[model samples]
Target chain A: MGRQVPIVDYLVLDDGPPHLVAGRCRGCGALYFDRRNGCARCFGTDFERVPLATEGTVRSFTIVHRAAPGVPVPYASAIVGLDGGGLVKANVVHTPADPEHVGLGMRVRLTTFPAGHDREGTEAVAFGFEPA
Target chain B: MDATGTVAPSDATAGDEVWVLGAAMTRFGRYPDQDLIDLGAAAANAALADGGVSMADIDVLGAGNLYEAGSGVGQRLQKQIGQTGIPVYNVANACATGATAIRCVYMAIKAGEADMGLAVGFEKMGKMGLLGAKPPSGEAEAFEPSGRYGSVMSVEGRLGTTLMPGVFAQAGMEYAYENGGVGFEQFAKVAEKNHRNSTLNPLAQYRKEFSLDEIMGAPMMAYPNTVLMCCPTGDGGAAVVLVSGERLRSLSDEQQARAVRIGASVMTSDPWTEGDQVQPDVNTLTRQAASRAYEISGVDPSDLDLVELHDCFATAELIHYDNLGLCAPGEAGKFIEEGGPERDGPTPVNVSGGLISKGHPLGATGVANVYEVTTHLRGEAGDRQIPGARVGLTHVIGLGSACCVHVLEKANA
Candidate 1:
């Protein structure tokens, strides 16, 4: 691989251990993964970049068997409520995609994997949550 | 605005109201041979003939479509039928395209811009597989942060897939986790009921009935929603003719007798909510529209003789029971268990088999739901007819988030 890059701008791969960066609304403290013009709840324009907690619990999940072309199926996709204060949508990795394997309220932690490589051989890393 | 948070006033004056002079839908099924115009004209002509009027009498036309929305579908349809040189409104609001089209006509009449209007929705979709979010064009060229996040393909499979089944499955699972009693069986029963109901609708894409065993045994599309529970993509069209109250009085006695009064029409988008940031809250906007429709119509949820709700998935149907106020919040499980939505039950729902079995042709679905309700309100729905149906409600929700709800009442009821 030529160079490793985080799939999203919010994912900080250079700083020691990989972690997600989010914009915390200064007004109501609402956390978001990407840049925002204004807070949806409070309409706050100012925000601070903050690193999210590495651990969270699954709020909800689904075993997606059907998907668009080129995407793998039977993966456990979840809505994870991060510790401290935040919610995210991501895939639950290192486990089977089933109710018995991935369940609601299950504890998980942030993890990264290679998404794909571009023409220049730069590896794109994507983030997901594995059972903690 | 008065007390009670906001004022609820009828869209029309006390004496002047909008009425559905005629409502018609071509049987929802696959039609690889016919095009959009052919299907649309057939439905439009049927509605005009049913209303005992010609296209010359229509002052406005609203066309609801999605695939070819930018091409002025309304104008193209006018060319097929008589070109009355009427103002045409072309609208595309995701799955609610058809209902939005009808609303355009309804508002035109209610605003006194036209005394008579026509709204038609048609689709020529053949067979599209699972509805999923596709990567944005030009974003996949290089790995870069384009807008909200990374390149669409770069983030693919990282954040849960936004495929329709997965989105709704997660939504349903979230509800079941928060509110106890909803399970695999509860969801399967919904598909079973709709499939059974489809047997009575001759126009439904699938008329065969599937048992609970069959539904549960079907291939899984998502966690709780099986392939059987999902709506099939197909081609069809539906149309409705609307007239002002004054114009209704001028029609023949038989025509006036068949007219279904438009009690209330309301459309709402998603309100600011915290959960919506993480997942689509399909309940809130639907509840808002349903509440507003009830307030404006002065009809309680209990007063509804029948309902035609958007059941794009079996899971969607369960939560909408609560969203539509058919049952108390968190009581949707009990509502399904007790057969509350059965055709012969107190609150009959999806008697037309819904999008589940009746088939969903995107543009056609929204107006088709209205057509189902209007048919029952006119006492024209045979076989599957709810005895002496008087008041009925039709609801449609399109996820980029728009919802439309209309309450129909038998004239003079």
Candidate 2:
């Protein structure tokens, strides 16, 4: 998990890091990490540069037994509360451990994993959370 | 607000006394390892024990679970607690599964269907996944890109992040910017507060307390919404015991004192035609339910002492504060900042740490709320109890953006 990438922040993504994007609000001076074409605060359309936090709190979490097309199967996911008031819903990295350990208020950090190879021979990446 | 113009036949203090002769619950939170039927059985036992009733005393069992498929839930629960030949049913109303279960019980006893009845709800939400929605009841299902649906829609209803944390992040950022740009620190405060309250709850899904630094440092799923703002799925169960007036006579002082009356129960679905909030008509359900309850119980919100609202998301909880008439309209951000529903406030919402702090188990959440109210009413709620709580109410709405409200009055009152 250690190849240097051209991310905005060494620990964070620049814009769309496969599973991440930046959202900016025009009506309000609020900037978001997830891509929001319309500003949630004031419904503004303009946006600027932003990167996501690498770490956050586990507001809530769960494991998925069923897998859909895009997400990994038999994996864990959490609703992470970032350090900057931003909330992101992503899968947890570790799997099949005690569900009790992944609970509300638990610390988690964001990292990327291979989403699998796309049909076009391109490597796909997605975000997930790990025990911090 | 259009009043139903409906008046009750009986005035307050003129109706027959209704008491909770039985109450029980399985511990709240994730329990993927245990069979749901086992959990339901445990709760049923606790409730029957609380009511001091024999298996023969349980004439009817009203059951609910959000997720449809569970291994041996129906049989396992009945096998552990009740004898064969008891009605073990499943009720699903998205999030209001528990409320509907209790309401059904109230109706059974009031109709003289049974001297004593049990309403039990349990959920293994993680087993069902999030778009665990649109009950595969074989109805025509439409997949829209936007997540907001259900309830009353207004022509002017603007769509927020329908994916949840997305909509709420917009709200949180708006609130922060509205207040001169507060940052993640403010959001952390919320997570910190709710987690602290949860620590005191013995049955809470999470018992650990988090610090501001820890909350702020969490992952960011949505802008302005960090890991701290979301309530992921969990597994849990909740149960309640109901009895006619005749059964309360022989209950121990502990059970007798906890005999709270179910003054009112109401429910309504979402009106998606209008362009108001996610469901502009959604609040109508709560209001209607509360109105009917107040009429039946003779206690208005003003006379009520505590409450538990569905706080699926932090912003949702904030919006509900104003929507429920706990405060003026569109003033929820101010309400939270001012300590309106804080532990020491006039009315404390989510005293059981709410879905935000306790982890939402969907099907069981409705029943879970009632259990907390009952505990607080009985003065048995250890660290999270409201001091001398006499009157309490609970509200829950589901995927249809339906609203279900229940009002309870203390035995002495």
Candidate 3:
């Protein structure tokens, strides 16, 4: 099989269930999906690699009917509070893009799907949350 | 009597009084044929005439413009409106560009750097679409990984791209989810009120009024935000003339009468964190800036005669009413429902129809608000005038998230 690539640098594609990577502040335990220079809360530079939980709860969501050129419309965007720690914004998949259907406090699990191709035509993968 | 009976021979301090001698704005709408400099020059010339002064009297130029005309915009503006080779500075703080330019001149005059200054803001939003994110460069790269760049590179950012309306719609959704379920109807009420207010403002882009039902039934761009609730992208410019108190004495009595004292001007930026709630996302910055303005002006929210605030979206106006301390938290929707922010209400807001109806020209918006407030304070607002208006406030929040608040009082009041 050809090698697969993750769309963003923070996602880890390995054996077993794929996990999202994050930086955890050693001082205040604040988690960030991206690399950190210092903790905004404790102002500490010490950080450690931590994998984010796949399950999370939707804090809020919106059905974006309009978007940039080439991006599909009427997709549901959400702020998901991770069960492990940290918060992330992602698209909701396998769920109808309706207010009544996708709602706050809804349980969801992280899942990866084929996004598009890179310059070399290798298949790239993107992550999102789906109704648990 | 020390020659003039006024306090004399005092050393100039940073706290020295500053006055807005004049303010003017082009009617905010699309001007496909006009360039940004032309818009800036027209507003600047009108402001100079309104202040009863000529370009030769302006000691410096502070200009604000968002995009397109890259560097040396101030110099270009001066070239268009008679360049006296005065020192010129260009300021760009996204939507708060105009207000930031005003603050720059205010600081200069306050520090006695110059007795008279001209601040102008112009922008031509050529097209309305999603704002693409550019890669961070140089020093910005060090901090970019931890900031918005991180969010933009995340899985969420890749799944769906957001424009201005989407961002505000998310905030509105979060507000409803957090609060006891504020709905689209309340948001529609805000659009209805501002569109109605625009009917009286000749400079407003959308002068036709829309009923709440019509606004609610309008095309939905995002959940809870209809087409009517969003400010249209347009091109325009606004200018303000600032003079020191000592310099004010040299102007004609009629010019002095038209002046409005810049009691306080404060600007602040976002202290955002990952996963922080977004409804009151701008509250911390706005509160910090507005509190300082109120303290400096010695004016409370209840003491204001009128207010002109940034309403880029209908929901933004609702949230700003709380952010500016005009109402208690969770009371913004109720305040609107009771007609508390009408032209005749206890604290009139957006008496110039706000960005929703007046059109948002990015760099020009902040100064355009100043123009509206000055007209009201001078009792020269014609039919849109707030009766006995003595003090007014202008608040603007730009999205890389900066907030600017200015308090103005009738010069002699």
Candidate 4:
């Protein structure tokens, strides 16, 4: 059997529990997920790897019924404000894609599911926020 | 000293001013036959002809094109128009490319580097669906789970998209969530007004008027934004010629009478903000540019007789009403509902049908906006004219994010 792997480098799979990682600025305590050259807030050259919060509230979202071909539709793409700190853009999963179901200020927690495996039989796990 | 702390060119003391000598735009719609250079040369020559000037009179050329920026469009356009060894600036600032191109020429004339300059923005995007980041080219690379963007399959349905409609849909929704009294109907009205206004704009891409009910009933591209509300991707080009104040006096009385003074030209990028990281902050940079333009021109928002703002989507237009200081904070919903932006309303906006009905050819939009405002300021905008319009504003914002605002005034005003 092939090993399971996180979809993005920021998503820590082998860690104690599946959690996302961020670059916390040493200068002004700003956090970023993607690889950043330096802290935009304080321009600090140094950054400390920090674990990001799993639960958050939906700050804003859009129910995308149309997308590029082969990409699934009727998904609630959202921006979530993590409980402690940090904001991320992700899709709201495990919930109906509608304002009645997913909306602003809706509480959600990070969750992972297996995406299609590669030719090598390695399973790529992706993260999304499901209703908490 | 200005905001940048650089010793300013004391406008009051220097008596230096830049004026739009002439402006013109080709009809905005699909043109499968015309190449970028052909469209660019046409607009450039038409603007020069309108200004009663020729390429020999131009000192600099600022060409605005998004997709073909690397091809030195300005130089290529010169080959078709005239081969003058003037400095050419090829610019691509997302949707603001056209506005930025005009700014380059405006600044050059203001800085005394050139007495007269030409700026043209053009794009040949034919029926591109849903503007977003283009997928990678060439054969598909094997998905490495720990690669830069991670496995392509894993990122799917995980990371949100940067599609224009969705970005604007969320932006509009956020505005409604923060400020009450906005919904699908309110957003649809924005499209309806623009489409109705298009009926009067002969050069518009789509001149047929659509009722509010019809707009609301159209196919939805994203939540709240329907196919009718979104600006269509098309091919078009626009251009302008700028002259220094000193050069204006040397021209004929008719030429001088047609000149529109460039009261203010300001471009701004997004300042750091917490919310900007998650959602595109189309507001802050716009507000900053608007305020700065007002300050430079000494013309308040209340003084604006007309406006041509970027309405790539109907939802974008609503929020920009507040961002452009056309209405009080949290009053944009009421502004449209009260018909404040209608053709006969207090502040007529997008009178040239805007990007919604006029068509949004990314590179051409900015200069086309300027062309619309100049047309009105010159009292030459037939049929859709705002009577005795003397002061006008043109604004355009690009998503990577840059915002450009310009205040234009009638020469005599």
Candidate 5:
């Protein structure tokens, strides 16, 4: 296989299904997908590495017809409440980007795809949600 | 430290009072040729003229700008308006930039730090969109990993490639799905209302009104938000002159008669939360700020004669109706249906067309809100004046997120 890399450092790529790495606060159990110096909830600096659930439910979504440059338009962006008590914002993919196709409280699963390719032909992978 | 291990009390809130002696703003619209310095100077000069004061009389200067201007920008602005070697402080709090500047001057005069102060806010957003991208910097890069910065990169990397319109549209959709049935029509009604209200405002960016059908038919920027429902980016500036009661006594009777008392000014930031609720996430900050302002001013929301809220988007105004205590939770649609917030209604809102129609020049918006409220309080808002307006409130929210609420009362009321 050719070289591949994750767009954000929080996403782990392996032979198996993609996993989201997060920092779990030891005191308050608050999870952060990105590395955090401290926990805002409990003001605790101690944290443990944890992997988030790959399944989630869409709490809210919108079909954005316009976005910043280089971001493809007409994508369904959603706030997905994960199964184990965390929230993630990701694009709902593999379905039409419309209110009829994607909706609130819809079941979705984490999936990975190639967002872009480097000049060296290396694929940069990104994560999204698909209908579960 | 005291012997009892308690610090001595600071007389920050002594018996001194602050009043807005003058308020002025440049018409909010596109001004590609004008720079930030020029806009800021125009507003400052106009406010001084309106107050019948000279630049040499301004003791301190507080300037607010979001993205365009930075370090030493305040000094540059003051120099343009004939600086007098007074201190100039620059403040930036996203959309609340202008209001924060006003708050700084208000507190300074109340604390007897200065006899008179000027609060000016200006923006020259040439092509920057509503949610513009900040230039790369070390601070921005450092905050990127924490996901605390509300940038396009952070939002897109975490969520999808969606802008602000999408974020707010999701909230509107979620609110509609969860609460008492609200439809796209209700959102369009807010746009229609604000656009219609703008016709009476000479300084508004969009003076044309559109029918509900036309608004609904406009190209959708997001699912629920059409182009007309969103406030367009523009260039403008606004300024306010604040004076202490001691200084007001020294001023001429004409200037004192035009003054408006600063009843209260409260600023609040976002509370730390584990996750975001689609409806009441950032809005909770607004509620906290507004509650404190009402308490400090001893003015109930129902008793207020008018309101100038941060209506950056149509849904935001709808949500603010409940957040600002203008109506009960989930009754925003009902409130609009009853014409409670119209110009001649029980409580006039955004009589100056709000951000949607008045144009959002970011840093200028909060100060512009103050200018509008002050105009009505002084009985000078011709054609769009609220009849016998006594008390008015202004609220602005900045996104990483800070909220500032200011309550104004007629000097003699």
Candidate 6:
């Protein structure tokens, strides 16, 4: 257990720090994460490597109840519009328990958690939201 | 030809009618405790009551359910509620399920297939987890490219809530840069406005009050859409009762006055031969539907004092504010900056807080629009009522593929 690194995470670590990832369209200026069948903005098929935005504002949010097994209960999630002009919904963290204070349009940004720490320590890392 | 010129089906040679004698809805939310069968029967019973007729009078039963388990819900409702030998027909069309059911019953009556018909939309939203919100991949099991992913949320559905918030963030940022100084706070003002109006509506899922700063500080779902911009999922059902022309007018003035006339109702499925730009198709549908309703009812868009549009997203509502011709196209965003449509604007849309505030129960949402429109026309939308609302319209676009627009008037004839 002396600083063991998963093969996938170790491989990606050489590429960049902060380890954020997104897909940028080649044909159009559209941006997406995960793989896209086609570009939603300009219907462009080509995409390039692009860094994910670090900051944004909260658009909407909700608190989840009855969590799945191995996950924390009463998790906070939100829609964050990034500084680069796009939106992403993720779990909210380092914020108040009540959603009233989370508020819409307030400045927010991206956050990441320890890989494999979530649920039985899988190699997958996750993102959370914080006050910008 | 453009979308507005399309002709309406000529079912009436004048004096023919499809009268809404009854309507009902299941309480909207997660039905962890309720069964679909019970909910459907209850809604059908409520509709029968609203129509002043018993289930015995129903000649046809049309059930609209979005979940796979509810495929045969209409027959179950007919069996439980004991309809009068009515042939039960199940209708499915994604978010437009209810509208399809209503249209089917109306067309069946117009064609003389049934004397009276029942249209019901029931949803057990939390039962199978989420009924929709699936991937856009063609290979996925639930992928029905022809299906609707709700009217507004279709674009950002599978992408999770992030990209949606991002677009809103861009719009909000641009709005601030364009205007002197306004940002999320401005969006918060609109949320505050709707939440304030929602307190008076008992049917609303979220009746709690929220302040400007409070909503402004809420967690963002996508950057511009805080939790307030989005609608909650609720378990609810709505039913409509329709009958032929003669049986409707025989009632007293008080009874006759409650009749919500269906002037011209048209459902259009867009041809996918073109690209995915839905703005033109929607605009075309609205114009043509409005035109036909105007011709049939002899009233135009300028004459309507109220409207209950499909405001699934703030962006959709903002875009539609112009597309619906409430004002010029590009100026739809100005209404938020200004005090327009504040439940007292020149022609208020969604005075009942719409899907955003009132809640969207998927299968029941289309019928819910009808309920709000009918209430406004009947002068019964208590705190959010549009005073002197005589003629109105309820237009709901399902996913991007189809749009169902109905032109309504107060009187049957």
Q: Write the per-residue lDDT of candidate 4 for residues B243-294, one digit (tens) a residue.
A: 9888888899999999988888999999867778776799999999999998
Q: Chain A alone, TM-score for each of the models?
A: 0.95, 0.70, 0.93, 0.95, 0.95, 0.73
- For residue B307, model 5's alpha carbon misses the true position, in angstroms, by 1.1
**For model 4, what is the error of residue B164's alpha carbon versus the real structure, in angstroms, after optimal superposition?**
1.5
DockQ of each: 0.60, 0.03, 0.34, 0.51, 0.42, 0.06
Write one digit per residue (lDDT tens) for candidate 5, span B232-326. Answer: 99899999999887788887888888898888899998887754422226677888999998877777898788999988878778878888999
Screening candidate 5 with a backbone cut-off below 3 angstroms (N, C-alpha, C), the clashing residue pairs are A89-B159
Model 2 off-target regions past 4 Å?
A: A1-132, B1-17, B69-76, B126-164, B167-190, B250-254, B276-284
List ranges where model 3 is wrong by over 4 Å: A119-121, B1-15, B130-157, B276-280
Q: Indicate the docking level reached by candidate 6.
A: incorrect
List where candidate 6 sits over 4 angstroms from the true fold.
A1-132, B1-14, B127-190, B271-297
Which candidate's DockQ is highest?
1
| Least accurate 10 contiguous residues by lDDT in model 6 chain A | A2-11
Residue A28 shift from truth in candidate 3, angstroms: 3.5
Clash number for each model: 0, 47, 0, 0, 1, 41
Clashing pairs in 4: none
Candidate 3 local lDDT, B26-141, one digit each (tens): 99898889998999999999999998888999988889998954677899888778879788879999899999999899888877789999999999886755455333221212
Better of 4 and 6 by DockQ: 4
lDDT of 2 by residue, B197-251 (tens): 8888888777678787777667654534456666777887788887776666655
Docking class of 1: medium
Return the TM-score for candidate 1, rounded to 2 decimals. Answer: 0.94
Give Cα distance to truth, residue B73, candidate 4, Å.
0.9
User: How close is chain A of candidate 1 to the true chain A, as a TM-score?
Assistant: 0.95
Which scores greater on TM-score, model 2 or model 3?
3
Ranking by DockQ: 1, 4, 5, 3, 6, 2
- Candidate 5 stretches with Cα past 4 Å from truth are B1-15, B133-158, B276-280
Residue-wise C-alpha lDDT for candidate 1, range A1-132, written one tens digit per residue: 378888778889999788887898899988877668899879989999998888998988888877655678788899888898788888999988888999988999999988877666677788899999
RMSD to true structure for each model, in Å: 3.7, 12.9, 5.4, 4.0, 6.4, 9.2
Give the TM-score of each candidate: 0.94, 0.65, 0.90, 0.94, 0.90, 0.65
lDDT of 2 by residue, A96-120 (tens): 5234555556787777754333233
Write the residue-wise lDDT of candidate 6 on B171-200 in tens digits.
343334333334455556666767777777
- In angstroms, give how far residue B188 of model 3 lies from its true place: 1.6
